[model samples]
Target: MPFVKTTWRNSISFKVLLAYVAGVGLSILLIALGAVALITSRSDILLTTDVAERTHELAGKLMFDVAGHPTGFDDSEGDRVWTFKSLGVEIGYRVLDSQANVVLASTDEAFWSPVAKSPPSDQGRFKFEREGMLMYAATAPVERDGTIWYLQFAVSERLMELLHQGFAWPFMGAGIVLFSLVLLFVFGACAYFTLGYALKPLREVSESAAAISPRSLHSRLDSKTVPSEVAPLVSSFNSALERLEQGYRVQQEFLATAAHELKTPLALIRAQIELMAPDKTRDSLLNDVEHMTRQVQQLLLLAETSEAHNYSFAAVNVGEVVQQAADYLQRMADAARVGIVLTGHTATQTPWQADRSALFTLLKNLLENAIQHAPEGTQVRVQCTADKLTVRDWGSGVEQAQLPHIFTRFWRGAHRRDHGAGLGLTICQEIARAHGWTLVAHRAEPGLAFCLSPPVTDSPSMNSSQESS
Candidate 1:
């Protein structure tokens, strides 16, 4: 069974919208709870205040009645008790002497306590607990016959408790419902606006891309609808497409030129073979055929290098590549009478990640170019460093005026047109670009130096090797 790999997915707008919804919902819920609590607390306070006010008014009325009696109040008049019952509310009051004995009584026993303790303070409201009931009682002291008398009144607290519980659920439910509706509307509106604004640019990008094809490489995305945050990305994509189109055109031209060059040599070799004498000169014709074949192979390799996916890269030992290239070009170098010297070749190896074949071709081209241009007996020095390769030839250096055009395709230097085709330096530059490396040529004090350096890679421990040819 083959193992399947799963990619993690992420969406920025969805996450942001979800977070906003959650925050808004939580805030609404908290506000709803606070509103319900505040209203309920105010209702409770009003209920309590009403009850207190009514009790105080009733006490005042009773005091007025007692004071207005013609005989004034006497113990023998049989203490009067007044009880008022209305709207399921019962209030009771009694008068007592300083001995703490009840002088009057109320028939509403549920609202009055016979054994209720005296108030702690004089002339103020007091609360007392008795018989599993809570009582809000007020005591007023009156002077009669030079003696202090106490008047007390009480109303049961059960009524207030019932009132609070009665109104609680309805108000809480209404608050919750109202807040839920508000939040629902808010979230829906937010989602709509956010989705529309965020997806607008993406939709435009899709439309533009859909209308584009290989033939319409010049078409570009509309910048007006694109958000500022995404504009740079769109512009960069367009630029990259432009570069790809230009590369394609260059590649087409290269193929046409390569085909023409290769066809000429093949035709020449074939003609030479066909005209060979029947017996003796066959070997000489064969040599010419081999030479033509080598040239064709070289041209084919150059063509392949122009392809986008031609090379597979690996860590190559630069020293090994330079040694091989030098060995292959030894005879040509000897014929030119230009001595090749390899220096700074160390046992310590520097390995660079590159296409092995491409690197070999690049080194060979540089070496051959130097040999062809250098004066006789002048040594061409190849030097290697940890990250760079340098090839120097002690010969007639490149003219300053022609240096800029040396790497252009088919560009022949001022004094070296007959030596070979001028595609060597151009091919070397292409290889360097494909590998993300840098190649530079400069005139040294006595000759020319071609330097190549490997690009930096993410892995620090993976050292790069350099070779000069």
Candidate 2:
């Protein structure tokens, strides 16, 4: 089984998306802390205002003068003070004279101070633990007719506790979870969209670059729309393609020019051998010259067929093309004592879409190959359908190992008896591929079968059909 590879995990977009999500998580944490701080500040202000006001009111009722500091306040004001302690409101007060000595305190010593510690000298409200109980305490200066004294108040820490436990904890915990999810989702979507929008130009450049072949060497990737970070790479790749195109053009020109340059000398050689050919040596020399000439022509043809733009596609009559190839090679087949057989109705009825001359070249090469290898007195069968063409010959097929390289240029495989250039099947494959077809070679029990058709996953059956026939 082929491994299906996925690439998103390796992409920059995925990495950037993860980075955005991480930032969002951190932002939520900072926001949570800030919210708690703001709520704590507002809560403290409300507690302090109420505590200070009550302390001031209770101070006005008592004398600030040290000499007039009364410990026995048997009046309505004192009753109100006792009411708070009796009802367990946890509010306590201590009035101090000029020397910061406590002149009066609430009835319950345990509520104000269990230990004999001096009253808190600090002014602003604050929280502290006394005898394992949390308390909010504040001290403020009280004035009466130019005499200054200190009044300290303490309250139970329950209100602040209630604010945290009742609202802050539950709300913050839920808010963090919900806010994180929403932040990740929103930021994730935005990141993906940004990635797509940003990389679209690179995709266009890639697609255009993929289409650039030797035929399209003049084309260049457009760097204007690409991101600055990627533009240099694209420019370098385009420059590399320019150098490659120059080299490739030189190579192709060398093949064509060499093939053309050798033609006249080969022709003259063939003429000289033909003029003297009556003896066995002369005939053998003429045959060798002929074979060399064919190889030169095949080289020339390969140079032409290798370029995809050279093929002009049209609706070619498949049957007619096959008949023409068979007729053209009939003399050669007879010389080898091999018979040519054609099958299928589309041999006369046109149904295939292909390049006509290229198809003719393909069929000519295949038939010549089959004829050259076919055993004497045996038939080289040609089958045609609306969709495919098959050529099979009854001769010893190549080894299974050699079959795979049958179409490789100049690899003649195990066909040592052959004298022609190995470019016959190579040209056929180029033509077939240019027409979007597959030229597959299958080993027949007695010979080899070549199938020219569209690509298929199950090539074994389609490829070996001629052998079964």
Candidate 3:
């Protein structure tokens, strides 16, 4: 589950989808706010229209009577105000003189206090809240008997609020919910199709890249179909592969040519040294020539094994190969006064995919390295199972810190030997790598063991059998 979450977190398509949804959701929220503002403004406009029309009607009715009286008004002539009050509209009204005195008023004194102190010249509409009710008021001037009188009509907003809330709240809430759900669905569908369509070319590029390997470095990416944003990276990768292929070819050629050129003279020198008298100096010279010759031979073998094309992979028996290598190295083991023992083979031959010549060279180097490191009268054991071979020497094992550097070319330990230039184990590791095997070194009970085995991908069944055995 943690791995799944990690993959989801790193997914570009998921991130893109989330970003797209957030952007659209923010836009929808802004639009919904604007819509709410519009609805509220429209409700206020409706309330104001009702107040204005009522103010105009009241002014027409009261203009003549108020002009004649210009004093405290009686209830008999207040026809519209009385009718509106009877109908429970909660409207209020008043008339004022030029000095802002209340000449007439509704029975509800609190309703008219919002506009009672104003002048006749202030003949316009206004709005305010009074006692928790939104009120809209309008004033009109009536010139009668040479006195300016202001007639005002104001109404509570309870009816408007009821009408607005009756429909608006449900509509806005459902609209927001429905819009969000629809937007999420639509955006998710569109993003899936869009990303899939857009990344199709990238998928093609990936598949083509996966087909390329170290053996096929000449293959190039087809940039024509790839997105322009990614073309340069693919081009750079191809250029790097080209450089690596050229460098590797040049190195292999140099090593092979140099080894061949030095072989003839080194052979002649060894022959001449053999014909000389058996003196200490002569023996030393012969040993040096033999070491030089061994180095040249290892160099040529390293070059040959380094090339991927040189491998001829087939199923080879591990037991048979170990016995052959042991037999060939027996004389050297005897000279070193080190006993060579081969054991740990199954009755049924275990077949593993390998190149015959490279496998032999790998075993030869390991056996020789063990023999060289083994103390006199100590035994070097060669053990073979289904897919593995190990060479363990009963000598002083390498220190734990220096074990990692054992396969490096020309690397020697502190307790050094006089013979090798340290290419033997390097060559062995190179061959194992070229054949896609693992060569691991671990400390044994009293010495060190170098184990060569095929990779799990190549020999799963054989490795299982070996482990069980």
Q: Going through the candidates in order, what is the number of backbone clashes in each?
A: 1, 1, 0
Model 2 per-residue lDDT tens digits across residues 202-318: 778877887665556878999999999999999999899899988988898899999999999999998888889499999899888888888899999999987766766555678
TM per candidate comes to 0.45, 0.71, 0.68
177-249: candidate 3 lDDT, tens digit per residue: 8888888898789888998888788777777777665546677888888779999998998898799888878
Clashes, model 2? 1
Q: How does model 2 fare in lDDT?
A: 0.75
lDDT of 1 by residue, 1-469 (tens): 1233233234556666677778878987787777667555755355455555654554444433455322222334334332233422445666667676666645344445444455423436666565666656666666555666666666666755554556755676776787777777876687868777877887678677775644356677776678888888888888888897787768756775886677777777777777877665877676666655555555566676665467666777888888888888999889888888887656428677778999899999999888887888788888977778899998778788878887887677765523355678888987876676778989897789999886656221123332211
What is each predicted model's overall lDDT from 0 to 1? Answer: 0.68, 0.75, 0.77
The lDDT leader among the candidates is: 3
- In model 1, which residue pairs have backbone atoms overlapping below 3 Å? 350-465
**Stretches of candidate 3 exceeding 4 Å from the true structure:** 1-11, 39-163, 189-216, 219-225, 275-277, 346-348, 414-418, 460-469
Question: What's the lDDT for candidate 1?
Answer: 0.68
Where does model 2 exceed 4 Å of error? Answer: 1-9, 17-122, 125-134, 137-155, 200-219, 345-350, 455-469
Whose TM-score is higher: candidate 1's or candidate 3's? 3
